[model samples]
Target: MTDKASNSLLAKLGNQLHKNKLVKAGEILLLFIFTYTFIKLIMPLAGDNPLLIQAVVWTANILMLIYVWIGLKLRGESWKDFGLVFGSISLRSAVKVTLLSLLVFVLAIAGFIIGSVIMANITGIPEGANMSGYDYLKGNIWMLIITLAGVYIVSSFGEEVIYRGFLINRISQIGNDSKKATIIAVILSSIIFGLIHYAWGPMGIVQTGFMGLALGISYIKLKKRLWILVLAHAYMDTILMAQLYMASN
Candidate 1:
């Protein structure tokens, strides 16, 4: 990077991450490493009542957002910086969000298909993500309803906030928000998104990684209207859970 570019990058990052470029990059790397390692350490304890441990992990993930919130607060920022505001929800916007969600959902599906094909070629039909984590939803009507609420709070909404809003935006900033920087952030965020689904195994990782890539791209294209991404994610979750529920019948 040129001096001007380097300066720009520093100015954008503007803090702990900004000052120490190496540390900033490593922070991202170390987070995923730590997260997965922590999960692996705890998962074995879930031999029989897996739901207990899964719930603990799920709540931990949800609570993990507090770190981001506190980081923002410490910097005199708020989630508004991450596009979690209720901005002028007019009829036009509702329609726009709906349409954009559909567009992104299509793109995500295409990404998933491509990822699936690639995984198949690499691993001879990759084993899918372990849905046993959610096996409680099978024919459990109350659980389905409760899970819907839980997912909307954690998976559909929270994951987008974590992956697209926080990771992409911060990573892009650390690179000075250049085109290349944005692309790198998107790719890195997508990979991490895939990794978080470690229970899915290799195939799940690749497939979700690609889907995350599509979502990341859509996030940037949509001018970071995070609600759109959340809606799109919700659509996917609804479909998956519906399928799981139906499959039991």
Candidate 2:
């Protein structure tokens, strides 16, 4: 093709990416996975310090946020477009949604436990697959505190923004926003959410997937208000970390 023709083609592709949520979503997902995978690959060289691991993980979250932010700007969107605004929902409504999300969180935990038990009975636990990061934080108050903050800020806020807010909205658009399409989007996003926790083992994957599903449903039902998911996720992580600390002590 001629130089002018190639330039026109490039411009068309850029415009399509800006106009299509699904394309933007694909770019974001690929970018996140590629960056995170590279980080994980180099983690062995970084040693096994929990603090270092935490830092690396937080870096991945920051990368994800940057990618999403750029994508939103390219599309002429704001964070509020992805349910990142507090003023969009009233305090009373936020409280109601949060309470309901907590209920879902509890049920999700129960379901995950039951699923894990059944899977263990059938196949036994996988080797080297038990929860592995907490040992580093055992009896370390400062590390525990850092971890708590990281989980709330990075895991809860960052993951909710990427998985539930971005993925669900983009994937649903891919399906033309039909009911079935939205449901499929929820499931697909949840599966990816679970896969991202592969270090947690099979049981963890299942549990996280279930939790993601619940969060995705809540996101949709609450009109994409993200505060509920963020609160629920932070509460869940807080409980888990508290339990881990208590067990260690």
Candidate 3:
């Protein structure tokens, strides 16, 4: 094609991305890839300082959130588009969702326990390997507080927005909004979530993957209402922090 023709094609593609909300998805994906690589490079330099590692993680998530916010603006979308509307969901509905989420959380923990037991029997993995990530926060009161705040603010919000709201929606578009496409997106996103927690070892991967699946399913059931997922995740992490604190003491 001629130069002008090629330029026109590029313009059309850009317009398409903006029109379909894929622009934000592409930008976020690129940012995530770059940030992930950068973290891997600098982690050695940061050493085993839990605080530094936590800082790196928070920085990455915050950057992604900013990028996502910008993407939403570029698409002329609001938080409501990502199921963040509080006014539309009634108070009664909110309470019901919260209660149901707690039930789901309990069931998820049970599933994790069963899965861990089965995994141990099948793989012969020792118990302590699964507890690797918890050591950093154990008995560190200040870090524990910071971690709890981070889990609720950074982790719960950032993860739900990126993996569920953005990824599932954008990826499903690739399959032309088919049910199979959505299922694929949920599974793919959940698998990535699990793999990203590799520091927690094999059981961690299994447990996290299971949680991801549960959250993904909930996201779908709730019509992509991220607020519900955020609450659920935050509560789960709060429980974890409490357990960690008790164990350390």
CA lDDT of every candidate: 0.81, 0.77, 0.75
Residue 63 in candidate 3 has what lDDT? 76
Kindly report which residue stretches of model 1 are placed more than 4 angstroms away from their true locations once superposed: 1-23, 26-45
Name the Cα RMSD for model 3. 4.6
Ranked candidates, highest lDDT first: 1, 2, 3
Q: Count the backbone clashes (under 3 Å) in each candidate.
A: 1, 0, 0
Tens digits of per-residue lDDT for model 3, 101-154: 776666556646765776678789746335445567777788788788888778
The best candidate in terms of lDDT: 1
Task: Evaluate residue 27 in candidate 2 and report its C-alpha lDDT on the 0 to 100 scale.
Answer: 75
Query: Candidate 1 — what's its lDDT?
Result: 0.81
When superposed on Cα atoms, how far off is each prediction in RMSD?
6.5, 4.1, 4.6
Cα error, residue 43 of model 3, in Å, equals: 2.1
Off by over 4 Å in 3: 1-14, 18-29, 86-90, 114-118, 126-131
lDDT of 1 by residue, 158-185 (tens): 8998899989987987787999999999
Cα error, residue 15 of model 2, in Å, equals 3.7
